[model samples]
Target: MPVGFWVFPWDIEDEGIDRFAARLDELGVTSASPSVLYHSGRALLPRAREHKVRLLGGPGANYPFESLETPLAGMESASAPGTGKRFWQGLAEARSDRGIRLNAWAMPMHGSELGRRLSVAVVRNCFGNPYSYALCPSHPQARRFAESLVGELARSRIFHAIQLESVGYLGYRHFHHHEAEYVGHGPLEELFLSLCFCDACMAGARREGISVVELRESISRDLERRWRDDVWSVGVEDVREALAANDDLQAFISYRQATVASLVSSLAELCHSESTELHCFSAIFPPTLEHSTWIEGTDFAAWSRVLDRLIVFGYTAGGPGAAKVDEGWTRSELEYAGRYFDPSRVNVVLNLAPQYLATLDDARRRFRTISEMGFNDLSITNYGMTSETRLDWVPELGRVLDAPASST
Candidate 1:
């Protein structure tokens, strides 16, 4: 298997590029996917070198690109201040010296700064409340920002591939710190709440022959009823039933898928033109058309035509007892992805945290399972957050993953 380590700019800066590259080499890592465009956050220590918390911004950007020179109207630049080593330059140097492939990891639409500043461009719930953390992908300005960002990254020419994250509409639920909102929200409710009915999205739906007005009213009525605790058990099946019954709802869903596909296709073109391959990191699992389309606006079939590879999160560590369940989930995801994209290009990212995997044995088992599934590419969730002891598993896991396939 081709093993890649997911790293952050600060991780490289603190450890020093040479040392970091050497360590990865020792661990038998074949590639490095470093974050180039990322959201605001601080890295936890013990696992990370002593470094100050990064107050949410793209830290690696130093040189001015014409695409990002002029700020989008009503939005602030989320680029972190260039105070120390330039990320792209350092990464390029390390790649040259260490001979490891670099894949630029970027988050296109998940900038909280842009969403907070341009509330109108953010995703809105059925109650017309804006999620000021996720930029609505259908927003014209948001799409332009994403395209320009991708173009600039491709032009940088430092990456073997560009991995995009959060390139679709974000749902209501998130892993935000200190989140305390408890509204008895179920999966179906979260799905309903995630649907963006912003002006751009509504207009797009209308263009796709959807009755936006009727759709909006229907959603509003359902939300109102749910808010009052009047509905009993709203689940994925309920959402499916609604889609089956309502033409407008179905059209709106189709429009969402098309919106995301169009953006990805445009980015793919820019990347290809610049001689950079495009990859996507999506949370939409099982790779089913309906689940991917309705939940996250991802169309795997459409993406397969453009993306060089697709990496899906297979962190299935609910607890020690959930190993079998995790394996089943991971298998299903890889199997589904193989239906659209080649198995060689479908990578599964595993979580190495103790909470996700209790022991090294568990990690070894999971790694072997992924290899047995015929996936040639494997990645770990993160390097910055993994402990020193846990880091030891990389080389061992690499050995297991790199082993030749067994004869039946």
Candidate 2:
């Protein structure tokens, strides 16, 4: 199996490139996914050298290159504080020295400053409340900005592959700073409330022959009733019933899927044109859990058509304090995703922190299971959170990964 590590710029700077590369070599890691266009922080190190430095807060691009002028003007771009070495340049040097593949980790639509600056371009719910965490995919300016950013990353020719995150719609709930208390909301209700009724979204729904006016009114009335009752009904069937009852709602969901698919397709074409591969971090929809696509507008089947690889975050085991471990959850999620994506191209990401895995023995068990399933690609959650104690498990995992496929 080809093992990869997800690293932050802070990790590289805190631990010099030589030390970082040495650690990766020790762990048998073959690739590194470093965050480049990160959210709300820029690398402050002069060069990508060893130093203990914290990332400064604020929304801006951290790439070494200047922001390409686009139709949407005034996009912010910030270079690293010291040596002003672009992030890609630093990673390129490490790649050359360590002989490791470099994959650029990018967050496309989760720009806090951009969303707040252009509130109209942010995602608005049925109640006309804007979510500052997400830029509405249907917004023309937001779409153009995302497309332009992806094009720039692909054209850079520094990354072996661009791993895209947050490329779809965000729902009503977010882990924002100083989040307020909004109780009595069910998951299904949250999904309903998260439906975007912005002008662009409404226009798309309208074009799909959905009666946006009627759908908005219906959703508003339903939400009011749920809020007054202070009760939420669970299960996917409840969502199915609601959609089945409302033709316009069903049409709108379909429209959202098509819109997201089109955007990804366009970006994938651009990546292919540059001879760069495009991959996306996708949420695994367990059969028992709420289907995330309902609110996020991610159609895995559609995305598989354009994406080169589908990286599923299949962390079946819970963190340190988890009530119980469900060993079957990971396999189930992977199998479910296998229906839509090629098993060979599906990279399963495992949680490496003690909070997620109880012990090295537990980690070994998970690795054996993945190998038994014939998965050839695996990745750790991140390098920043891998504690000194957990670091010991890396080489052990490498041993299991090197073993031949199990017949079981």
Candidate 3:
């Protein structure tokens, strides 16, 4: 079993790598995935040497590659640690001595600053309004940029694995800063609005013989009905079921998945050349969890063969009031994903947040359930974000998952 934590460079550098690795070693953590690149986010660190509770990462990879003439739109690599030692070098040091496997976490297209700065065609809604946070893979510039960055990371040969995240289409409702919405839509509405009809996506769909005009009209009508009537109109609760009633919708979705898969296939080929395992985050538009990656253009049928591992989210915690999550939710989601993905090539990410796994007992029970599911590869939600008390559950989690585990 491989047990690890998803952490940022600041997470390790905040307290210094030696101290951070010592903590992980004490908790029996086998792997540490430090973000080589990421999008924007605010984090709360429990063991910070400074600003224990402060703004965290943003878009860009700031280390010393000197690849670009000017820095990315944000603070040049997602709030890099302004410490004496560089994160990559310290990470290598920690890995060499602490036996911690370094997973290079990179967000390919999910960057608010970089996307806006580079003027890449991001995912646009049926109305043609850009989401700004996501770059469409169909765009040549976006594809080339992602390929160059990821290829560089793989060639570095410092990481045990290259964990690719947000390598596919992203959706609306990303919980942006002070984000607001009136629709309060469920799966269908969110899915329709999240569909990208940008020029790049449009041209690709047309080449695939998909009718963008008809699809747009279909989505418009559905949204109009949903907005005014407060119903899905088709009375279908599940996204798969709803999409089944429409051939164009299904075909467009398939095209999106194929585009994403093709990009990953290229990246995987590059990683293979460098002897680095390529793992992708099977995520996007949650409440759908494992089943919903399709909405964001990631599909096991398309990516499983090419990817070294597909990471799926199954949260038992952090759900809306008690009404959303139940005892069987995580198991059901994992079961659905297991039906499609090879267990040997899957890593299930569970929450370590206190709201979900409050105590050592909760961590123990969750670990046992996941272990029984035959998912030997597992990752906890994060390191810096979880509270001090909640992080104490790590030791118990390690005791339960001491065999093997990893994260990014």
Best by TM-score: 1
Summed backbone clashes in each candidate are: 1, 4, 9
The sequence of per-residue lDDT tens digits that candidate 2 reaches over residues 1-408 is 688888776667667677888888888898999776666643333333444344444555555535544333444444232444554576677787888988888777776766766677888888788887678889888787778878888888888888887777776664445666565766668677668889999988888888998888888888888878887767777777887888778788888878878888988998999999988867422223533554677788899889999887656446564313545767776777778887788888887665566777777878888777767789886777566667668887888878766522
State each model's C-alpha RMSD to the native: 3.1, 3.6, 3.7
Residue by residue across 1-408, what tens digits does model 3's lDDT show?
Answer: 678888877777767778888988887778888777777766677767787776644456644444443334233553676742356777788777988898888887887876676665677889888888888888877887778777777887888888877888888756456787665467677788878988998899999998888898888877887778766523235676768888888899999999998999999998999998899887743454335667778878778778888887756446444223633676777777777776778887877665666556766767777777777788887888877877777776766765443430
Write the residue-wise lDDT of candidate 1 on 333-370 in tens digits.
Answer: 67777788888888788878876788888888888888
lDDT of 1 at 283: 54
Cand. 3 Cα-lDDT: 0.75
Two-way lDDT contest, 2 vs 3, winner:
3
lDDT of each: 0.74, 0.73, 0.75
Tell me how candidate 1 scores on lDDT: 0.74
Better of 1 and 2 by TM-score: 1
Model 1 TM-score is 0.90
